[model samples]
Target chain A: MSKSNNVYKDAFNRCLRLLDETKSLPSEPELGTLLGVSRTTVRSILARMEETGLIDWNKRNKTVLRAPRSEDFFPEEETDSLAEIIERSFMRRLLAGGAEAGMQINELELAREIGVGTTSVREFLIRFSRFGLIEKRRNSHWVLKGFTRAFALELTEIREIFELRSAAAFAALPEDSAVWADLDRLELEHRQLASEIATRFNEFSELDERFHRLIHRASHNRFIVDFYDVIAMIFHYHYQWNKAEERQRNEVAIQEHLAYIAALKSRDPGKVDAACRKHLKSARQTLLTSIPEGRQMQPA
Target chain B: MSKSNNVYKDAFNRCLRLLDETKSLPSEPELGTLLGVSRTTVRSILARMEETGLIDWNKRNKTVLRAPRSEDFFPEEETDSLAEIIERSFMRRLLAGGAEAGMQINELELAREIGVGTTSVREFLIRFSRFGLIEKRRNSHWVLKGFTRAFALELTEIREIFELRSAAAFAALPEDSAVWADLDRLELEHRQLASEIATRFNEFSELDERFHRLIHRASHNRFIVDFYDVIAMIFHYHYQWNKAEERQRNEVAIQEHLAYIAALKSRDPGKVDAACRKHLKSARQTLLTSIPEGRQMQPA
Candidate 1:
């Protein structure tokens, strides 16, 4: 659910930057490549822009569409939701290649990079400041904060409970709802991903997120959705903590996801519960192993 | 968990305003009455204030030893978490006596009234703006958004599922955990509240929040806790729609909570689940009746 929004925020930010610097809007594939996101994300941003009169986008004319006016530059008021935009930018910074704990984030630099006003960035910084994920200095700069191993352990336990409940809910969902169709598609995708794990192990993170998101949506609860966004932001994006075993762990996770899907499809509550617990336990172990001997445990 | 934070936010905001205007700290009772919160809230705020160098205190000097410096006014940095502070003020106004849907909320006025910077409020507003609970005008003012019956119905369904999961988790918690002690205290409080329902019906709202909060804590998931904050804000506070039946409904709710606590103390998951569903069903009904004939259903 949230991954799609992150794509939009990243794509739109890239578009804004490109428009400012190069005075041109890139094609969908070009924007996707430039932003390192997905073409679907690029399309969503462009579609939203067209809806809001930010651009005159059409399938026949994909290039330019004319530059957005000054009045169209307020990012929070258009395209993605504010939480999505904020989380996307924050996760990107947190998961960026070569990113380190305790890195200082320049507010102005972030505002420019994300193509939002400094005030919008400031608003998000203040929101995240509550979580100790970032702290505003007396000089007004923000510093990235590190999580302790204990934080991760505690987080894993909580995530287990949430996922278990979500799995049970998914199994119990009426077969007639549109959710079943989505789950069918996701299950097929899961099988395909598991089959190609040797070649496409890196794609597991996105698939893992979507697989759990399907179960989460079955509950139709906004609270779970919102809270899962935080969980997804941390676990899905924080894989950079240990890149050495990424492929191996992802291969194991795909197998677990496949079994989990099989159990869910059976519509047996106990089976689904057991499957969720097994996969989540594997996930917890993988998460713990990814953190190197508490080197990242320094308090923020 | 989040309720305690809300208390601090409300109390600290009041104290900051008082110190600025009067140059003197108010006594606990005075502050409580002035802010329309509780003495516990006032004390928590003062304790945090003392810890943060916003004040000085001891058995001998129970009052502020010195006024805070001008730099101490950055609210999100001091006293309470930003989310709590924002939600507390927003819930208060939305559920305030005689407050109506579609009421125009002046940003400057709310900032002054809450004793927080307009920026803090704006940040919070933007977050809630995503939910359509509030809206930002081109002129920068905001308006209170009304929810339809369909919205409430959908929300109630989701809340039911979340609470059901929470109740089961609570029942499964080990007896050795500190949550057991808290549940004992709340159980006794529930009985006491039930005994005085005729005259103390108003107090049920507070007790109801605490009762559910204790179960919510048993899960110990920050996501559940955070999600429950939204639930508590909506259900606990949004009870002013049908004041005429308030006392009668509260009486019924008190009985339900008593049964819920009894079932929980039994350590039987089945009993606990049944009790939770019963109480939550009553809560859902009460919520539906409170909305006055679709008077507040205009989409924001």
Candidate 2:
């Protein structure tokens, strides 16, 4: 929440959008001026952008302008952001220590919105539906179904332990080829996802989901993944809930995501972990601040 | 497995089981003699154990030993050894992408052997039932479910992605008083879970689940946890088939878990992340190697 970090985020998002628009990487200084931030932050952001393969990390000359083709940005294994949103909402309770939150979303629209073919959306739906996040109803229309507020608190508790385990596991990575490669890939994925900003909250939700899951998957621990998944499902919230941010906050969020991307690209596990905690802490603060006159943060 | 590592593991387990026999800790020479390993391996294992809080890693003016008392060895809120068997099964999949062929188990008898509460048994049944790993008819008898060879391989892909997200969020944690204490407590829980030896495949699987869940629960990232949950539920393996050696690998698992615990105690994020990947890799390799002649790892 520092003023400095905020400027970095703004400049970062501006560049991402600009890249998407121009289909070319712009001069680093250009983004800095456009976002009303310093050139230094912009340069670091650009550096991070390059590290993640979102743009090639430039070399030799100072005035690097050619950005990666927009086409290359979209990976072949695209995810459904909407499905991810709904599923994430459903899981919020699980992680928070609440019962499942269920909802059926429009697969076709959700897929289109996330910029993926419908194939992946259907698969996502099927995956969560079995777990009761999506349900078949008499109306024949997909509808959202579950919510348990306790999940949020439980999830907080679980994430604490997760960090501890990660702290343990990260340092202990075997000095072997595959394990080594996985560490690199995990760091790389973090860099890439942090740079791109989804047009909508739902889409961003999915990207973020894959982003974290990629880290866990790279560790290659199914029990860790599955256990995480269960608590997550138990704590899931609906897509409707992530709607309270002020416009300024939302803008700030895009930059934070970008900064996170930059941190990951640095390939310092300590930094990524720090960024991850910072991100979660902000949300926790937001939730804390948002509590109303009669509302408190406790199991509902 | 390396001969030295196995030798160290055997010695560690012997020391672990002898908790009631000793008033305090053992010395390095004593440990070396106990397991017939060289003095050097004992020193290394003891150092790692100290880091994990399995022992007090004080500056040894004369020697290394002094494994902590039982209460110091584990937290009050953790799952027991038998439950750990089941839980660690998940750990293997979460990190390593492997599931050894488990043998048909009598749920009731297995429950009694491990001394876990019956509720845990039922929870396992429910989980295994969903994956079709176990079948419980109307009469209430649990039967081993049929499985194909491809189950472990396919599960690895999904599990890997799950941990990646976890790692990202965990790496994000910051050193602030607001939530740092909670983070420390969770870390302690992870250390306890990470350091265990599975006596049975079924128990290992249970422990694996608990260990990873402990981490996910601590992560507090709804998006990361929920997405992982839905996908994890779809991925399951029956422990009804296994060779003697793979099952025996548990002999060394305790020491490995202890190493992870040590990393967490140090709060070094890089080491922790590496530790997680290393642990999971072991699990994945186990499953990869444990596939029976006719088995096919499941495809998501």
Candidate 3:
């Protein structure tokens, strides 16, 4: 709104961009000097970032927890929008405590707790309503819907079809396409994640989404791109349902991803299909185990 | 709602079901005796059915024009649901006159013409809003969006991938699955359509949807099933955009469908893939041609 405000916003964005290169933040005095801002202005921006869980500011230093994602690029505000903030908060809540079937979600309480307008929450809820993930009650409240094993199996079957097609298409893509360069970078990332699987296994979910989406994009099909959203939402969020074997599963998955990446690099249709199916089998098993035993059904 | 109303409703449902077996309705006096209702009740029900385009009652005979579909199973009224009726009406309008991008849609005027409340129309509009097919304007009005050639080509590419995977899966399915029965029935229908293609070319769209959906369902993938709705909606509705070559395209599509069916029946993965791709190529061509030439673009 003012020249000083613009200066701080730009600095905050620069700091977020820097997280992509380094996990540690510079000291407050050093950052203020680098950003050409006063220490007080730097502190205000850090506090906003801390509030949204983007970074952790300790007595001694600040650490990057998560980098700014495309969805976080808000022009009007230097911080996350109310929509994005609410979504992250709800996801964290769902992961911490599993939802029960037909569990009623109090809309008013959620709005009050998030300190966002009820209208925003209602619109968010309505958007998800189309996915059968949540249902709006007659009284204007919402109820959570739990996925059955059958549902996951059905989704996995579709995901396999989608990925196999995408993998084949990726292998067939021209060598000059930009996706080849991205594949190289993703392969390096997969290898890096594999090396640290013992400590950072939880980060595999985000990497897995990125890897599959990269392959899917090679097809250049809008339908697959749009539908992949549903697949990603369900698989990524529901990964929190059963965390007992998460580390072991993540290790296996990382290895599978390496195989998948190698197959794509080979650019052989037969080999790509084999590798894609192999990785999908592991994914299916992990998805099955992720569902609670009582809720799990026999493999469809 | 009343005894007489219930009787008339039952008779109307019975008449609709009977259309599956016969294309002609019995005389009113004979229908009254068969339904065990007075001639007056039969006449009232017939009038309602006629109003909904389910039948054509003339001076001497009543002919079954179209059978009742699931969307038309509204009990309290013989007509289609407000949502579907309005959707059909708007689609017809858009097809007859192409939608220009950013053309503002008056919600109140549409609701008035469709004999439905604004809320119903708004809900319907919101569902399609996610696809970028329509947009809710800042002033609470709506605007129409048109598909570019790139959009159709992208859809066709994804459709090809989906059907190819589905066909392969269908070929590998156990011989005892219910899909085999549907395939058998669909094959017969395809043959029937093929035999009469010269006269009944316009009916191919319905059968094409059924044939593709059967293959898609064989994979038992919920995401594919859900995403297929968008694919079907765009390809099916936009077919009306250019009717110049409609008959020829339908004839070719019918023939391709038959070959695709035979490939599936052979249970050979190679054959299935070849046949599926062949049909999809033709479908892509038809889709490209269906868009006005001025709107067509080089395939990505």
**Which ten-residue region of model 1 chain A has the weakest summed lDDT?**
A1-10
For A122-149, candidate 2 gives per-residue lDDT tens digits of 5555555444334544213455544333
Superposition error at B113 for model 3 (Å): 11
lDDT of 3 by residue, A1-300 (tens): 211255566677777777788787888898887876778878988898888888889966688899788654446454454556678677666555556667788878888988777666766676666555566654236887656677677777667767887899899988898998998998898888888888999998998899889988876765666667777777766665557678988888888888888988999998899989998998788777766666622212
- Predictions in order: chain A TM-score: 0.61, 0.38, 0.67
- Model 2: residue A256 alpha-carbon error in angstroms: 2.9
Instruction: Summarize candidate 2's per-residue lDDT along B45-122 as a digit string, tens digits.
Output: 666666665556555532335544554333323423333455554334423433224544455775675555554555
Give the higher-lDDT candidate: 1 or 3: 3
DockQ scores of all models, one per candidate:
0.15, 0.03, 0.26
Model 1's DockQ score? 0.15
Residue A284 CA error for candidate 1 (Å)? Answer: 2.5
**Where in model 2 is the C-alpha error above 4 Å?**
A1-149, A159-207, A213-216, A222-239, A287-300, B1-300
lDDT value, residue A186 of candidate 3: 88
Candidate 3 runs further than 4 Å off: A1-146, A168-199, A255-278, A292-300, B1-82, B85-122, B129-146, B168-199, B255-275, B292-300
Q: What does candidate 1's lDDT look like per residue over A143-239, in tens digits?
A: 7755556557757765676677778878888778787788779878877877787788788788888878878766555545554666676775566
At residue A181, what lDDT does model 2 achieve? Answer: 60
| Winning model by DockQ | 3
